[model samples]
Target: MRASASWAIRAVIAVTTVSVVAACGSGNDDGTSASPADGQKLSVVATTPEVADFVRNVGGDGVQVTQLIKPNVDPHEYEPTPADIQAIGTASVVVKNGVGMEKWLDQTIDAAGFDGTVVDTSQGVTLRKGDPDDEEMAEGDPHIWHNPLNAKIMAENIEKAFVAADSGRADTYRKNYRDYAAKLDALDAENTKKFDALPADQRKLVTNHDAFGYYIDRYRLEFVGSVIPSMDTSAELSASQLTDLVAKIKATGTKAIFSESSLPPKSAEAIAQQAGVKVVGGEDALYGDSLGTEGTPQGTYIGAEEHNTDTIVKALGG
Candidate 1:
């Protein structure tokens, strides 16, 4: 009877140990814990590189950011992979550059079965209406971050979301947002002074796509036209459109055709050649759709905007 009781006790201990192990392993299928461990950084998934940068700045060391879209990749044409969906599934919050930028976002979220808080950074910022003719951008231009003031709104939205998701770190997030906002203000002021110094005619811009509307509007520069003719890079240019753009470039006396880092420069180069204008390709391409490589100066939002300003100013004879 003593041996039998001892055996029963051992069996109970084994069952309890197994139960504990199973409970610990029964997290999301993506290998993430069902909930963040105490003191663990909040898991965040940002739909785009720029959005990821904003989250990083606002969340600071309090969040682990997973950027769905890679750097230098066009967000307009990006298709989320299984890994991206899994990341979203396990994330505590998802941040996006709303205004129809991520057309695939809703479906991707559904597929991920995510029930996390979503932060749309474009909220409260004034939106620019797109060309009514283009179906993709007929709603509105989604690239609001090009304007520094608009970016401030985005950062504010991010900070709020971060605080809501992790209220324990609210102070840290707010402080980071304020610090980043100051940097953005300084960047805007410096760029404004430099751009205002240039003649209005010399501020004309021709780019690979209609991605710089906010930038142009913010700095009061004239946009001659774009190679793609639409805000979305996935849009194709027809023969007639190409010919008309070349004509417009010549008529506007646009000095340079600026290609985007995320797009193919062949089209811009061809148009520039036809229009007899210099094409800023290769390293000098603008970071319109995406940021530069991680760990580089242009990888950050401020760095990319500065590069764009310097490139445009130099190319446009500023």
Candidate 2:
């Protein structure tokens, strides 16, 4: 089997069991959730913490969200455990960052016989195609959350899902969606303001992987290169590929590159060493795949974007 295949199998151990916290009470020892008090809140199952944050923002007290992946977990390499499968089976709705982001979702849902409403948050957002030669998806790119505008699109989808699950709360859900949309608009403007101040040449971004295409496109920045040229971090690079990347960096005079907190920075450090430049240092690395660990500034979507924008501005010498 290929290494990616093994990655899927190994990822099952990453999450031991479903954490079924009661909406009214506390967590259960077994992998079963307690019912909501008076059954007021909608039980929502979101795939990532980032999406779960969105649900909280929009759903408010009307929703009780259960996230499958923990903080700093990479969805690309994540495989659902039996507990996670059980959790989704009990949810009224499931929100996914769809455009091939969750390759394991279908199989897991099938095993659980889940018949809930699935909201693909990537709907109506323009997507960047993967490399024509990529084995997994030559026409799909799953990293949609990098662009704040795309978050607006996703937010709408999330709200729609919540409303659909509980039509009586449609008015409430729409109001919350509008409020959250304003926040995303503010974030987009904030980042664009900083990015627009930078010199066009300095907008070149090199990073651990070929992520951030949406953000780059939105800000009119350039994605110069990456140490790993694929969206999946589990993919490896040949020595020749790294050498070529180093040469590209030297030629482009790319000042600073970055890595993510979720993914290792070893390849980035190697490229920086060969190119004679420094990898970006910060309170947190970038938060492309997962948000920061819990209880930090970068733990939330907005906070992570703030950290990422600051890092990019400082690295690009804006």
Candidate 3:
């Protein structure tokens, strides 16, 4: 009778322990769940390298981020493969630049049955209206991170998502966010000073596309026109549109025609030639859609922003 009693007690204890263990590792209420490899840290997936970097800055050592898109691969035209879905299959959190940047994100995550919170960094950002010519951007611009002020806002949103998913380290996440935001604030101030030095009329920009609305608008520069009337590089340009752009460039007295690093510059260069303006591109090309390759100068968000400022200043007669 004593032996039987001891055996029964042990069985109940085992079952209780198993239940607690399963509950600890189970998914969260917000649809996030992950079997952590080392029984610690969240598996996070970011839709773009920019958002991936933001997650890194905010999550610090508490997360392992998987970037959905790579360098030079335009997210606007990206199509997720089976491997991409499988790579993010086990994520506890997924971050995205949600002003319609990653159109494939929701569908892919839903289809893959991703059980995680999709954090949209653009939640608090004041988005610019899409280029008048691009019907696809009826929702607004997705390049919120282009403006340094918006970058600060994105950091806060990302921090909130991190805390929600890993409340155990809420303090650490908040501290990290504060540190990252300080850097963004300093960058914004620096860019503000640089742009302030340029005369208002000289601040006008003629770029590869209409992607600089937030950026130029922030710095008080007039977005005189673009080589492509659309915010997206993939948009087709008619001869009449090109001619009108040339006319606008000449009328605005725009000194330089800026072509994006991620897009083909042949059209911009042709426009520059036609308008007799300098083409500021190549290494000096502004990182419009994607960041630079990892480890390169412009691979980082700050580096990319600084590059754009310096390149534009030099080209536009800073």
How would you encode candidate 3's per-residue C-alpha lDDT over 7-76 as one tens digit per residue? 5434444434333333332355664553354548877888888888888999899988889898767777
Cα lDDT tens digits for candidate 2, 230-300: 88776778888888888888898889888887787887887788899888745548887888877887888
- Model 1 lDDT tens row, 55-79: 9999888999999999989888776
* Model 1 / residue 2 / CA error / Å: 74
Name every residue pair that clashes in candidate 2: none
Model 1, stretches more than 4 Å misplaced? 1-37
Off by over 4 Å in 2: 1-39
Superposed by TM-score, candidate 3 places the C-alpha of residue 156 at a distance from the truth, in angstroms, of 1.0
Would you estimate the TM-scores of all the predictions? 0.88, 0.88, 0.88
Go through the candidates in order and give each one's C-alpha lDDT.
Answer: 0.84, 0.78, 0.78
- Backbone clash tally for model 2? 0
Per lDDT, the best of the predicted structures is 1
Q: What is the C-alpha RMSD of each candidate to the true structure, in Å?
A: 12.3, 5.2, 12.7
lDDT, model 1, position 48: 88
